[model samples]
Target: MDTSEFNHGHGGEPINWERAAGDNAFVFMKATQGTRYKDPWFAEDFAAASRTSLLRAPYHFFDPQSPYDAGAQARHFARTARAAGYTGQKPGELPPVLDIESALVNHRAACPPHTDARQVAALLRHIEAEFGVRPVVYTNHSFVTLCLAGDARILKGYQQWLPAYQSEPPRLPGTGRDWAFWQYTDRARVPGIPGPVDRSVYHGSLQELRSMAGIRGNPPER
Candidate 1:
């Protein structure tokens, strides 16, 4: 599940973390936005998820046009996530996610004008330095084609988390890289999460997923 404070369960109820664990394999919660805004629910939600069997991860909403620069945003995200208890090195914890998409207001723009490929690459590098693991990039096809066009060589090294709402598998980016995770829907009806939740599928087997999370041995039998 890819979630933010706005995705709190129906009626503004707290998400049932234990029940979410039953229906989901992992959960990525929004931690920070730009360099100043921190998701208010992150601490509580992440602490709750830690007690469950779900793999826990944190993500940042990158504001490519921010005047604070990529390094500042990276530091903010890393610090926020660390305070929320996600280290990226913890067992069953995936690396931090860089949510580099169009700004909320520009969602329908032909090509988001705020996105910068160079800043994106710099943020990813700074995040890797802070977290000690290559960060996963959460983006869409349009963002890559229109915004990150000239940065394929820099982007190919990191994993991609794509959002493509179709039955068929998402088409690979021109970067010649395979998607690590594919979000197929934003209206998924999970048992524990009321209303709708974004659901995604990891591209590999459970064992492979564990390996990516730095877990040794096969995943525990369900």
Candidate 2:
């Protein structure tokens, strides 16, 4: 759950996989390295770790500009995963995720971002079309409320992965927010990874969670 799971260069030091050995159930490795897979090393390393498991799919931090939408994201996810060496649905893994957050929502001078609900939905669709598995949407409560509220119609078919650090998720009436995974905490201690990382444990059994990630078997020792 380390937020930097998607970032490549971080102040001269890449994230330590030792952090992956914490109590967290899932480690979401960022699929994009500034808009593309962070690189084989990141994915391979996380994929190689043991203390924790990774849903090795690209994170599409959607761009609300120009052509930002779900459809565009499907292509991004599918194409990126293909480029990164991921194949069709696996038994115990979940699908890709669309990250629509501050990086994309605010576009601050310090942050490089991507956002576009329509483009994202498109990208997700494209990913599912290519892999035959659905993609999940990852975002905070505010982003969900502001950006995705109206777009739920297109996303109802997909699973929502909420990035909220709550004991229990807030009920979203009519939002159809029945989430696939609930990221319970931002602060987590994992093994194999070095330092305190943002972590999230899944709410369901290992079987249920794995099914969503599209990883058929227990990921290889990571």
Candidate 2, 60-104: lDDT as tens digits: 555544444445445555666666556545533456666655444
lDDT of 1 by residue, 118-158 (tens): 78788989999999999988887666666766345557877
Q: RMSDs, each prediction? A: 2.1, 4.9
Off by over 4 Å in 2: 2-24, 33-41, 50-56, 68-73, 102-117, 148-151, 211-222
Clashes of 1: 0
Prediction 2 global C-alpha lDDT: 0.55
Q: Which stretches of model 1 miss by more than 4 angstroms?
A: 65-68, 104-107, 110-114, 169-173
Task: Give the Å error, residue 139, model 1.
Answer: 0.7
